[model samples]
Target: RVGLVEWEAERHLLMLDIHHIVTDGMSMSIFVEELLRLYNGETLEPLRIQYKEFAAWQQSEPVKERLKRQEAYWLDVLEGELPTLELPTDFVRPAARSFEGDVLPFSIDKQMTDSLQRIADENGATLYMVLLAAYSILLSKYSGQEDFIVGMPVSGRTHADLEPLIGMFVNTLAIRHYPSGEKAFLAYLNEVKETMLGAYDHQDYPFEELVKKLQAPRDQSRNPVFDVMFALETKEDNVQSFGDIKIESYPETHTVSQFDLTLVISLLDEGMNGQFEYATKLFTRNLIDNFAQDLLVIITQICEQPSVLLKDISLNGQSEQEQDVLEAIDIIF
Candidate 1:
């Protein structure tokens, strides 16, 4: 049994326990919702198929054909390009072996969230586009490269049958960003929206197939394509109670990826919470914290003043420190 207990100064301690098989981030959310609904006397129909069945069906021919198209598209897009983001390392980036990283989070107020949403709506774009634009600008500043790549997670559950079942139906797709001065923020966001839509239209392709088709070099030193991943999860109130046995769903341990960094944003009561996970061996905690804050500041500033140029977003006096770290890394590498 896996259990967690916490002590509070003002309130009594809370304890939680669950079987490993039934507990996961996604399952926890669903379980809490169902528990509440059941308590309210809401009867739900039985599920048509179990998760295992869905997994088996996912390996069928139609899915394979769709994946092939996705592989072809990615190969065409990434043909001969190397990673645009340059790391200050002399040693090659490691591959095959999985690495772990930690997360640093920054919070935004309700006003900021509302403002960003409004801007996105006004431009007929998505919140994802606004966030992606900010990320692109951040990458440009850090790497000193106007062209960079970010890997985004796509929900591969396109058909109705796959939605109810839980499995690893997630695919990573690379988005190439090129900041052209000729394009306005709104125009650039529109392009991103279109690209993402196209990606979704053909997301059934297996990522492994895409890698093979690209003939991506097998390097023990780095990831095949992109290192940074961005994900945004929509939030909901998830609380459960059975008489005196109350259980509140709160994130305990966050899973770290084998990439250099992963940026995740989830909605909170007041605003959005930004989380940044970085490889500890490659970066210091302070660096990760600063990077998160910088991205937040850039996004907030852009939302407040849409006319600002990409180059105008400053690190708020943190640039010197970042440069120092980069230089030290260069020397060590």
Candidate 2:
């Protein structure tokens, strides 16, 4: 669906709303790129493969065999009892899950960003690995669960042909990690990098298929496998100008949360910015605001001292005694 609202004589708002079933984050960029080319009277080459052809290929025997092998890997990794995160909520969880949510925005300065990148480089890991390691530690501290799963999205455009096509070639990976406080930060990060590499190898397996195969008991109030998700968005300038019309994106007021909590980080030229999109039914705004601040604290501490034990890290600059007092007073948020 597309709409254009005129805000002034020379200004307008263009809204392009597409369902997630047909397009993803990567596809949106492709769509906008082609849209601009056509708007500027530039011709685009015909797609090598249409969406239907790609769907058909997925159902082919060879793809089926490949998925079977990948399924074995997922099952082995997620074998035995699954851990459910028990994060303390501000309100009682609803009988049914709610999509109502809000975003808490935050940013990391270029200095810290560069430091993080250095750590990633020293450890032979990507920035995503470094951030994910820090995020896992925060979740462990909050939920008091050393082992749990966090959903990560993978761009499932494995083949070059699929890249130019605007379709839903995105897959969710249930990445489980055990963040032990006793372990050194660098050691844990390397472990996370290894686990992520393995998950990426089997990322082609559909998440829906994994859920069906796992046959876990359904919970109406939460998502299966993982309650929280994390994603790092690589920067892309999708639409620049439509023949000097000065095209740009317009922000929307309505927000939705597909999970209990989702942390999205975007790598920009200036630095790294992030937002925590969380379900309002399960968290207060103040609580999530503190989460954003505390996350930055965790990242700063770990980046400065990679050898620091995870347990030594502090949130919101609170000592253990102070944290306990706040918990006792029931005013931590």
Candidate 3:
């Protein structure tokens, strides 16, 4: 759905409301580039493979065999009872889940960001891996669940031909982790890096298909495997112009939450900025604020002492009551 609102003569707002079913984050970039080129009266070369052909190919026997091989990998890693996170919520969970949610924004200073990047570089990992390890620690602190899955989206454009097209090529990977507070942050980060690389290798497998294969007990109150998600956006393109027409991206006012909690971090020129989008029925602003603070504290501490044990990490001066609340989940160590 696209719209154009003309505020005044020579002043108009172009709006594009795309659904995830037909397009994805990477596709949006391609869409915008093509849109601008076409606006400037330039013709793009014809795409070799259209979306219809791609869809058909995905359903072909060869693709099915490949997915079957990937399926075995997922099944082996995810075998046995899956861990359900017991994160403390302000309100009782409803019989069924609700999408009502809100976002709490936060930022990490440039110095802290640089320190984290240095730690990542030293550990043979990317910044995303470092952040994922820290996030897993945070989840462990709150839920006291050592084994859980975190869902992340990967661009499914494995072929170069798919790069120039606009389509929904985003696939979610359920990254399972067993975070031990007794383990050093650096060690856990290395393990996370390995897991991330393996997931990337099998990124083409569809998440829904994996869910069907698992056939875990169906729960109306939550998602099949994971209720939490993590995403990192490094692309910073926001402002553009087309022949004297200035275009600017507007900040979104999100009213829906796809999961119980989602941490979205954006890498910007200024620093590392992000937001925690949480379901309102399960959390209050104060709790999410504490989460943000605790996450930052963990990141800062790990950057300072990469070998520090996760159990000894700080929680941004949380109150004794708050500490008790988190500790009450389950004392593993």
Each prediction's TM-score against the native?
0.78, 0.93, 0.93
lDDT of each: 0.71, 0.89, 0.88
Tens-place lDDT per residue, model 2, 151-226, is: 9999999999999999899999999999887888999999999999999999999999999888888889989989
Q: Backbone collision count in every prediction? A: 5, 0, 0
Residues 107-212 of candidate 1: C-alpha lDDT, one tens digit per residue: 8788888888888899887788888887877776677776677888876666776566545666778887876545556667777788777777767777676777
Look at candidate 3 and tell me the lDDT of residue 182: 81
Off by over 4 Å in 1: 1-28, 31-44, 87-98, 242-244, 250-257, 317-333
> Over the stretch 251-274, how does candidate 3's per-residue lDDT look in tens digits?
778888989999999998877898
Better of 1 and 3 by TM-score: 3
Once superposed on the true structure, which residue ranges of model 3 sit more than 4 Å away at CA? Answer: 317-333
Report clash pairs, candidate 2.
none
The regions of model 2 sitting more than 4 angstroms off are 7-10, 237-239, 318-333
